[model samples]
Target: MCAHITDSVLYRHLWGTDETHALLDDGPRVQRWLDILAALAAAQAEVGLMPDDAARAIADHADVALLDLDDVAAETRACGHSTLGLIRCLRRVLPEPAREWVYYGATVQDLTDTWTALVLRDVGALVARELADIEQAARTLAQQHRDTVMPGRTHGQPGLPITFGFKAAVWAAELGRHRARLTEGRRRWEVAQLGGALGTMEFWGDAALPLLDAFARRVGLAAPDVPWLTARDGVAEFVNLLALITATLGKIGQEVYALQRPEIGELAEPVTTGQVGSITMPHKRNPELSEHLVTLARLVRSDASVAVEAMVVEHERDGRAWKTEWAIVPEVCLYSHTALRLAHTLLDGLRADPDRMRANVDAHGGYLVSEPVMRALAARIGKHAAHEVIYEASLAGRERGVDLRTALLADSRVTAHLKADDIDRCLDPEAALGAARSFVDRVAGEA
Candidate 1:
C-alpha cells in the first residue's frame, strides 16, 4: 500500500503528473540504476580492471524484467545493506561469466549518484522544454492583450490603469530568466559520481581516473573532479533550482486563483465537461488546475528544504543526510514536473475578460486615474496647491459616493484652473496607461 500522496491512486493527480510519476517510479529508477551498473562494468573493462567479455554480458543482461523484485526486496531485508541486496539479486540473474563483474568497483553512491546525474539530464531537458512552452503561451497573451486595458491594483485597491499585456509580459520575462538558469546550471549538476569508499578509488588502483572518464562517457554524463560522497551541494542546487521554478509557477497560479473570483471575474482557467468544481455547490467554477500548481509548488519547496538540510552531512558517507536524498531528490523532481505541466495547461487555456477588466476599472468612478488628473492640475497651479485641490475633491467624492467629475465641477478652486472637458480627458483611464503597450512589445520581442 502506498502511503504518500504522490503514489496514492486517488490523490496522485493532485500531487504529480503521469509523465513525472513514470520517471520517478520504483521500476524506472531501478532500471536507471541497472544502466549505471552496466556502465560501471564497461568502464572497468575499458581500464583492464575487468574482462571485456564479462562487461559485455553484464550490459546485455542488465534488464530489470529478468530479476524478481520481490526476491530483491527479501534480500534487502535480510542483508541489511542497500545496494548489496540489489547486487546479490542482479548477480543471480547474470550469465556465469558476468555475474562477478556486474557491479565491479562501484559503491552504492556511485550507482545512485550517477543515476542522479541521468535524472538531472533528462528531467532538466523536460523542464526546459515545458517552461519554454509556458513562456510562449505568456508571450501570446502579451501580444494578444497588448491594448486590453485593466485596473492596476496596489494593496487591494485600484491605483492606476495598465494593459493586461504588460502583466503577461512580466511573466514571460521571468520565465526567460528561468530558462537561462537551467541552461547555465546543466553542466554543474550533470557530472557523474564515481568515488569509492572514503572518496578514493582504492579498488581500481591507477585505473581509477580512466575508469571514471569511461564510466561518465558510457552514461552520457560529465566526469566529476572529485567524489561527492560528503559534498551534497549538487543535489541541493538541483532541488533548489526546482524550488525556484515551482515558486514562479506558484505566483502565476495565485494570480489566476485570485482573478477567477466571482467578485473579480477578470480571468478564469479552462473548464471541461464532467469536471465538477464542487460536490454540493453546483454553481461554483473553481480554478482546479491553477490551484493544484500552487499545491505542487509548496510540496517541491518542502522537498528542497530537505535537500538543503541534507547539505549539512558529517564526515565521509553520512547515511543520515545522503539517504534523505533517496526520497527528497525524486520528490522535488516529480513535484516540479507536475507544477510545470499544470502551469502550461493553465496558461494555455487562460480566459482573459477584457469587458470585465474595463468594468472593474470604471467601477472606481475615475478615481483610479487620479495621477493623470494630478499631473494635469500641476501644470496650471503650483504642484502643492494642485495636489491639495484634487486631494480634497477626491475625498469629498468618495464620501458622497459620486464621480470625480461632479466633485471637481462643484469646487470653485478646481473650476478656476480646469474646464469640465479637460477634467474628463484626465479622468479617462485608457489615457492614463503610459508606456504599457511599449513594455509588452519589448518583452514579447525579446522572448
Candidate 2:
C-alpha cells in the first residue's frame, strides 16, 4: 500500500503523473537505493577505504530485481532500520568478500538524502522542460494577440482598457522568472548527501571527503562542501520554488476561468467536440483544464508549507523532518508538473473573443475610458479636482443610465472647457489602452 496521497488510486489523477510515478515508484526507489550502495562501495574503494575487488564485485551485481522484496520488508519491520533490509538484500546478491562492504559506513540519512537529491535532480529537469514549454506557449499567445484590446479588470470589476497581449505578456514574464528560479534552485538542490553517522564522516577516516566527491560524480550530482544532514534548507528552497511556479500558473488559470464566463466571454479554453462538461447541462463548456491548474497549485502550496516546516529539523539527522519530505517534496513536484503541463495546454489552445471583448467594453458605455478622460481633464484642472469632477459625473451617469459623456456635458464645471466631441474621443476604448502595446513589446524584448 502507498503511504502518500499521490499514490492513492482514487485521487491519483489530481496529484500524480506517470513521470512522477516513475520517479517515486517503489521499484525505481529501491533501485536508486541500491545504486547509492553501489556508488558508496566504489567511492570507498577509489579512496582506499575498502577493497577494490570487493567494491567491483558489489557494483557488478547490485540488481534490485534479483532480491526478495518480501524478505527485505520483513527485515525492515523487524529491525526498525531504514536500510538494513536493503543491506541484507544486497548482501545476498554479493560475493562473500563484497557482501560486508555494501553500504559500508553510511547511515539512513546518507542513503535517503542521496536518493532525495537524485529525485530532485530528475524532477528538476522535468520541471524545467515543462516550464520552458509553458513560457513558449505564453510567448506565442502574446505575440499573436499583441493588440487585441479588452477591458482590464480590478477586483472582479471592469476598470480599464488593456490588450490581450499585455495579459499574456504578464504570464510570460512570470513564467520566465519561474524558469530562472528553477535554474538557480537546481545547483542548490542537486548536491549529494554522503554524511556518515553523526555527519562527521568519522567512520571513513581520511577517505571521507574524496569519497563523497567521487560518489557524487559517479551519480551525476554535486558533492556538498559539508554534510547537510540537518540543513534541510536546500530541499525547502527547491519545493518553495516549485510552489511559486505553480502559483503563477494558477494565477493564469484563475484568469482564464474568470474570463471564460458568459457575461465576460473575453477568453475561452479549447473545447474538444466530444468532451463532456456537465451531464445535466449538456450545453455547458467548462474551463476544466484551467480550473484544475488552480487545484494543483493549491495542493502544491500545501506541500510547500510542509517542506518549509521540515526545515526546522533537530540536530544532525531528524527522521521526523526528513521523513515528512519523503512525502511532501515529491507531492509538490508532481502537483507543480501537472499545473505546468496543463498551463501550457491552456495557453496553446486559448481562444480570445476580440469581438466579445469589444462588445463588453462597449457595454459599459465608456466607463472603462474613465482613466483617459480623467487624465485629459487633469491637464485642464489639477488631478485631484479632475478626479472629483469625474467621480461625481460618473455617479450621476450610473444613476441616470447614461454615458459619462452625457453627464459631463450636462455639468458646467466639466463642460466649461471640454466639448462632447473631446469627451467622446477620450472615451474610446482603443485610445484608452495607454502603453499596453509598449508593455507587451517590452515583455517580448525582455523575455
Candidate 3:
C-alpha cells in the first residue's frame, strides 16, 4: 500500500528513524490532533468561553483510539472538509454535551498550524541534541589528528600541505554556528497558532485572546501576537535551517568519500563484518554511508526549496501554500534526522591511516612542496623573478619526467644560493603545515 519510498518498510530505515516516524506518522498525527482539541476545550473553559463540564467531557472522550478512523476518513471524503470528518467521527463516540464542544469555534488551520508548531518544537530539540553529538565527534577527530600531515587539495589536485586536524576543525566550527541558530530559532518557531476563520476571532467574542493564551499555555507553547494562518515564514525559517544543517553534513561526507579512494588511501570509513560494499567486486570496500549522506542532503535541500515556496499565500488562508508542508515538513524532518544519525556513526568509527597520508604526500617527490622552495628562493632572488625561475624549472621537471629536486639541483641559478640539502629541508611535509596545529588547538581547546 505504500507509494513513496519513505513509506516502504525496506527503505524506511534509510530515510527516517523510528523516533521521528512516531511523531510524523498518520496515527500519531491524528492522536495529536485529538490532544489539540482537548487542549482547546480546556482553554475555552479556563477563559469562561465554555462550560467546565463540557470541557471535561470533551477531554475525557476525545481519545483517537476510541474513535473509528474508517468513518472519519469516509466522512472526510464525503464532506470535502479537512477536519469535519474527524469532528463527526468524534461526535459519534462522545455523549451529547462533549459532542457539541469537540472542535468548538476553531477552523482547520487553527488545529493543523498548532500541531505543526508542536512538531517543530519536538523535532528542534531532537536536532539540537544530534548536532551537539556531531560537533563533539568532530572535535575529537580534530584533536586526535592535530599533527597528522596530509596534502591539501584545490580544484581536485594536491596544491599544498595541511594537517588533517585543520580539515576537521573547519567542520566543527561550522556545526557550532548551526547550533547557535537552532537555539535562537526555537522562540520564533515554537509559538502557537489559534486564529479562527480568516484569523479574526469573531466567534469567541471577548474571550478570544484569553482562550488563545490559555490554549498555548496548556500545550506548552508561546501564544503568538497574531495568528499565523497566512504567515508561513516561521515554518520556512525552520526548514531552511534543516537544509543548512544537512548541507554541512554533505560537505563532510564529500571529503571522507574522496579521501577514502584507494589511490589516496588517507581516510577509510568503518566496515563491519556481514556488510557488503559491492556485490560484484569481491575485494572492494565502498564508502556507502558517506555517499548516502550526500544523497540525503540533496533530497532535503530540494524539500527546503518547496518549503520556502509555501511562504507565498493568497490571503488569511491558502491551502495551496500551507498544505504543501504536509509533504515538505515530514520529508525534511525524516531526511535530516537520518542524515545526522549516519554522520555520527561514520565519525565515531572512522579510520585514518597516518602512514598512508604521509606516503601520499611524499608520492610526488618534491612537486607537492614546490611552494616552499619557491618561497625560500623568493627571499634570495626577487618574488616574481623567483616564481618565473621555479615555474620554468617545474615545467622542465614535468617534461623530462624527473622530480623537482633533481631539476632544481641542475639549475645553477637555484643552486647559486641553495644546495640539494636545503631543497630537502624545505620539502619536509611537516614543515609545510604552518599554523595548522595551532588552529586545531584553538578549535579543540574551545571544545
How well does candidate 3 match the true structure in TM-score terms?
0.97
Across residues 332-396, which tens digit of lDDT does each residue of candidate 3 receive?
99999999999999998988899998888888877888888989999999889889989999889
lDDT of 2 by residue, 1-447 (tens): 767677788877767778888888778888888888888888888889899999889878878788888889998998898888878777887888877788888889888899999999999899899998888888888888888888888988889989899899999998999889888778888998987888889998888888889999988899898989999999999888888888998899999999999978889998877999999998888899999999888888888998889988887778888899987877787788777778878888999999998888888888888888888889999899999999999999899999877888888888887888888899888888788888888887774
Query: Model 1 compared with the native: what TM-score?
Result: 0.96
Determine which window of 10 residues in candidate 3 has minimal summed lDDT: 93-102
Alpha carbon lDDT of each predicted model: 0.88, 0.86, 0.91
In angstroms, give how far residue 307 of model 3 lies from its true place: 1.0
What ranges in model 2 sit over 4 Å off? 1-5, 8-11
> Where is model 2 poorest over a 10-residue stretch in terms of lDDT?
1-10
Q: Give per-model CA RMSD.
A: 1.7, 1.5, 1.4
The TM-score of candidate 2 is 0.97
